[model samples]
Every structure is written in C-alpha cells, then in structure tokens.
Target: MSKVILITGATKGFGRIWAEAFLKRGDSVIAAGRNITALEDLKNKYGDLVLPIQLDVNDRKASFEAVNKAKEHFGRIDVLINNAGYGLFGAVEETSEEEARNQMETNFFGVLWLTQAVLPIMREQKSGHIIQVSSFLGLITLPVLGLYNASKFAVEGLTETLASEVKGFGINVSLVEPNGYTTDWSGESAFQTQSLSVYDPVKAGFKAAVSAPGIFGNPEATANVILKLVDNDNPPLRLLLGSFAYPAVKKVYEERLEGFEEWKLVSEEAHGA
Candidate 1:
C-alpha cells in the first residue's frame, strides 16, 4: 500500500536519499529542508508526488505548518520520518553550553515537538508510523561525540515511551539507528570548540579525528530498511542498520544490561518489600 510520508532535513545527506527512496517506492513525500533550491529541484523531478516544503524542524511554528501542509496534500500523514539532525564534536568543558544545548534542541527537542504535532492527527485517524532516525551513537556513547550521544539517548528514551503510549491507538513509533551513511556528515556540517585543552589528550585526539570523513555505510542500503519499515505489518520499535551499527548496538545493550544486573541489589533494597 502506498502512503503519504513526510521527511525533515531532506535537502542533503541521508534525508535527501530517504526522500528519493520513498518517492521511487510510490510513496508521496513531503521533502522538507532549509534549502529552497534543492527542495525545488526535488519538486520538479517527482512533480506532485514530491511536496518540497521548506522547513527547519527547530522552529515550532514552521514545523507545525509543514505538518499541516502535508495533511492538506494527502488528507493525512501515514508516516513521519524525523531525519533532520546533526552532530557536534567537543568535550563538555571545551564546547560551550550554548553549543551543547543547540545540539539537543535539534536532535532531541525538535523531534519531541514534531512528534507531538503529528500525534493527535495520527491518533484520530487510528493509524500512522513515526520513524526517528537516530545514530548508533543513540545507543552507545561516542568518545568526542558526547553531546550527539546524549541527544540521541534522550531520543531513544522518548520514542520508547511513545511506542507504548500509542500502541492502543494503532500508531507505531520506530527508531532507525544507523552507523554512518553516505552523507555529508563532515567537519563542514559540524561545529567545534576553539579550545580543546580542557579535556584530556585522548579526548582531544578523538575530537580532532572527527573533522574528516570516516567510513560511510551506503544511504540506499539504509533507505531499503526504511522501505521495509513502511511495508511491514509489524515493524520493530528499535532497528540497528548496517553491519557497523549492529555490533555497536549489541555491545551497548550487553554493557547496559550487565550494569543493571550488577546494580540490581541496590535498586531492589531501595524499594524494600
């Protein structure tokens, strides 16, 4: 079945690939991003099937307007893909508080606001899927990408809770945690601190390494997973994409579960029966 899908940050990177993938699958997509010319180009290629709506998901007003426009176009949104997010590399002391919070605003709170905006409509219709594109860092803590990890960790928690909340309403919330895809996720898209002397030398080294392009998993492969997510009768709430991400997610789970078990007695004692 074809569905109306909306993706944010569709001007470039994996978001753009996602838009193209969905459109090829015959899904009506609301291609949203900050770049007008890019969005216009998409509009020309896919014509009416691609609704290139300009959006910066950080703005509450613009975010809501995009949702409303998508609704107006398709009558309702079948899938909402929150893929418009970025990473910043800096230590806690090295990066300004303002920079850290900005990361959260885009990766964490922007998702929250957009999810909230779409919920009521999905609920009323008794159907929809919300796909939050978090990174493998969402599950595991990265060295210099502390702020990025922190924001995605929050996204993981939020989507977990959201999944349970909308179960009865027949709305599904899916999280896609990718390792690194063929996106322009380089230093140009990143912001770093002027001073890196605050953190230890190892952290500084890690921070410096992030400025260059690392091994990137294919965006098309990731988009194929997204297509699966859309077609499934029962999609998983959490999915780790790519060979690189699968192991990382597994390690994160094992470590987290072990830590919980090791500290279980203390937690149990606190809530004495």
Candidate 2:
C-alpha cells in the first residue's frame, strides 16, 4: 500500500535516495529541504507525487508549517524521516561554543522540533512512524567527530524515550544507526575546526587513515533496510544499517558491559548505606 512519506534533508545523500526509493515504489513524498532547486528538480521528475516544500528544520515555526503543508497536500503523513543533519569534525576542545550549539541545534533539536509538529496529527490519526537517522557514532564515538557524536547521542536518548512515550498512541519511533557511507557527509557537507597544534598528530594520523575509499558502505542499501522498517508492523526501537554498523556497535556494547562488570563491586560499594 502506498503511503505519504515526509523526509527532511530530502535534497541529497541518504534522504534523496530514500525519497527516490519511496516514490519509485508508488508512495507520495513530501521532500522538505533548505535547497529550493534540488526540491524543485525532485518535483519535476516525480510530478504530483513529490511535494517539494522549503523547510529549514532548525526553525520550530518552519517545522510546524512544513507539517501543516504536508497535511494540506497529502491529507496525512504516514511516515516522517528525520534525516536532516551535518557532521562537525573536531575535538571537544577544538570546537567553539557556537559551532557546538549549531551542531546540536541542527541535529538534535531540529529532529525534536519537527517531531513535535508532526506528533499531534499522528496522535489524532492513531498511527504513524518516526524514523531518526542517527549514526554509528551515536552508539560509539569518533576522534575528530566529537561534536557530531554528541548530537547523535542526544538524538539516540531522545528517540528511545519518544518510542516508549508514543507507543500508546500507535506511533512508532526508530533510530537508524548507519556507519560511514559513500555520501557527501564527510566531504563537502562536513564542517571542520581550525587545527590546533596540540592534537595535530592524532588528527593527521588516525583520521586520515579511516577517510579512505571502500570503507564506507552504500547509501542505497541502507535506504532499502529503512524501507523495510517502514513497512514492518512491529519495528525495532533501533535499526543498525550497513554491515559495519552492526559489528562495530556490538563490540562497543560488549566492551561497555565488560567495563561495567569489572567495576561492579566498586560501583556497588560507593552507594549510600
């Protein structure tokens, strides 16, 4: 069955691929983005099936307006993919307060704002799916991408709580934790901090090594997994995309568990009598 799917950051990368996949599968798409030209091109190709709406996800009012417009155009939104975010590459000390705040505003709060806007309508309908595009960094962490990790980690916590809160309303929330993909994420779309002499060696070594080709997975495969999640009646609270994502996250969890168990006696002894 065809449904009305709204995707933030639908202009490029995973969002664009997901939008295309849905449209090709006969679903209507509300392609919301900051880029007018790209959204227009999507509309031209898909015609009425694609409703290209200009949306700056950072603005609360704009998010509300976009949801309203989606309702007006498609009558109801069956799914909302919160795929709008950029990566900030820098150590915690390297990133300015403004840069950190901007990263959080766009990644964490933007998802919150848009989800808030769409929740009321979904509540009334008693059925909806909210997909948050988090990264594997949300589960683990990276050296230079600390700020990006912070934002996605915040998203992970928020979406987990949201999933529990909205289950009564028949609204499902899931986090898509993807590893590095062949996208513009680490390229033109990424933001970097001014290199400090202190961390230059660490940055130049490990970061450079991982930024090579073939390590990143394909975006289309990730999108396909998401489509399956959308169609699922009882979807998971978290879905890790790409081959690398699962094993990497699993290792993180195992290591975390080991540390916790090792410290169990010390942690328990610290509790008040």
Candidate 3:
C-alpha cells in the first residue's frame, strides 16, 4: 500500500532526501517548509505525489493548519517526520535568553505542536508513525552546542513519553538520533551566538573535535533505514542514524551508569525516611 508521509523541513538536506526517496517508492509526500519556491522542482518532477506547503514550524497555528491541509489532500497520514529544526552554537553562558527561547520555540515547541495536531488524525486511523529528527548530542553534550543539545534532549524526553502514552492507540513514535552529518546543519542552517573571549580555547577545541575525520555521515544513506523503520510492525523508540552515534552514545551511557553506581549510597540516603 502507498503511504502518505508528511515531512517538515523538506526543502533541503536530510528531509528533502527522504522525501524524494518516498516519492520514488510511490509514497505520497506532503513537503512542508518555509520556502515554497524551493519545493517547486519536487512538485514538478513528482507531480501529485508531492504536495508542498509553506510553513514555519514556530507558528503553532500554521503547524496545525499544515497538518489539516495534508489530511484533506491525502485523506490519511501514515507517517510524520518532524525534521524542522536548526542547530544553535554557543557556550551555555554565551547563549542569550532570546536565543535560548527561540531555540526551544522551534526545536522543541514546533515538535510539540505538530505532534499534538497530528495525534487526533492518527488516533482516528488507529495506526501511524512519528519520527523526530533528534541528534546524538541529545544523549551527550558538547561545549559549544549546549543549547542545541538541550533542545534535542527535550525532544528525546517528549518523544519517549509520547511513545508510552500513545502505545494503546497503535501510534509509533521514534527519535532518529544522528551524529554530525554532511548537511548544512552546521553551516547555513545553524545559528551562532555572540562569542566570548573567555571560551576561546573551549570553542577552538570543540571546533577541532567536530572536524575529525569520520565524525560525520552521509544524509543520503538514511533513507533506507527510515523506510525500514516505518515499515516495521515493531520499530524502535530510538533509532541512531549514523555509525558514530552508537559508540558515542554507548560511551556516554556507560559513564552515566558509573556515576549512578558511584553515588548509589547518596541516592539511597536521599530516598530514605
């Protein structure tokens, strides 16, 4: 059966790649982005297989309206890929209140609004897949990416809770945690805050770390994995997209476990009468 997949941030990068993959496989796509013009080629090439909608995910009303429009156009939504978010680069102290709020508004609240809007539709259908494009940074932290990490961490928590809440409704929710990809995520799509001289060394070290060879993955390679995820009857709640993600997350989790063990006595005492 041909599925109807709605993808946000479908203008370029991973979103556009995945959208094209779906269209090629006969799955209809509702491509939502801020730039409708960028989507014209997809519409022309794929014809009715693709529906481009102008949307800025930060707008809650627009997000809901976009979902409604997709439903009306396709008659059903089999999957939703919430991929509309950008990276915020700055040390925690260097990040301004406005930057932090804007980061959350789009990266976190955008996901929330769209998830809320689509729930009713999926609930009616009794089956649907919701994939959130998180980051490996969601599970671990880097110096300059504090706010970005926080945003993705928020998404991780939200999606995890949502999975449990909607399990009875046959809704599948998965967070796609990818390591640094060769996308414009860190380039044109990213927002960098005012730098602080105090953190120059930290920033320099962080820059060198990210520039390491094999730290990034190819975005095109993710389409098959995504296809398999949505097609599976029992998809994972968390799917790591890049090769770097697994080992990176594993090391972080191991350290976290060690910390918990190290503080076991204190933790028990805190819970005591």
Which of the numbered candidates is closest to the native, going by highest TM-score?
3
Could you tell me the TM-score of candidate 3?
Answer: 0.99
lDDT tens string, model 2, 101-173?
9999999999999999999999999999999999889999878888999999999999999998999999999
C-alpha RMSD (angstroms) for model 3: 0.8
- Model 1 is weakest, by summed lDDT over 10 consecutive residues, at 207-216
* Per-residue alpha-carbon lDDT of candidate 1 for residues 50-169, written as tens digits (9 for 90 to 100): 888888888998888889888988899999999888888767667787898899999998898889889988999999999998878887876777888899999999999999999999
> For each candidate, how many residue pairs have backbone atoms clashing (under 3 Å)?
0, 0, 0
- Greater lDDT among 1 and 2 belongs to 2
Candidate 3 residue pairs in backbone clash: none
- Ranking 2 against 3 by lDDT, winner: 3
Q: For each candidate, what is the lDDT?
A: 0.84, 0.91, 0.94
The per-residue C-alpha lDDT of model 2 at residue 52 equals 88
| Candidate 2: regions farther than 4 A off | none
Give the higher-TM-score candidate: 1 or 3. Answer: 3
- Scanning candidate 3 in windows of ten residues, the lowest lDDT window is 239-248
Candidate 3 Cα misplacement greater than 4 A, ranges: none
Sort the candidates on TM-score, descending order.
3, 2, 1
Candidate that beats the other on TM-score, 2 or 3, i.e. the better one: 3
TM-score of 1: 0.91
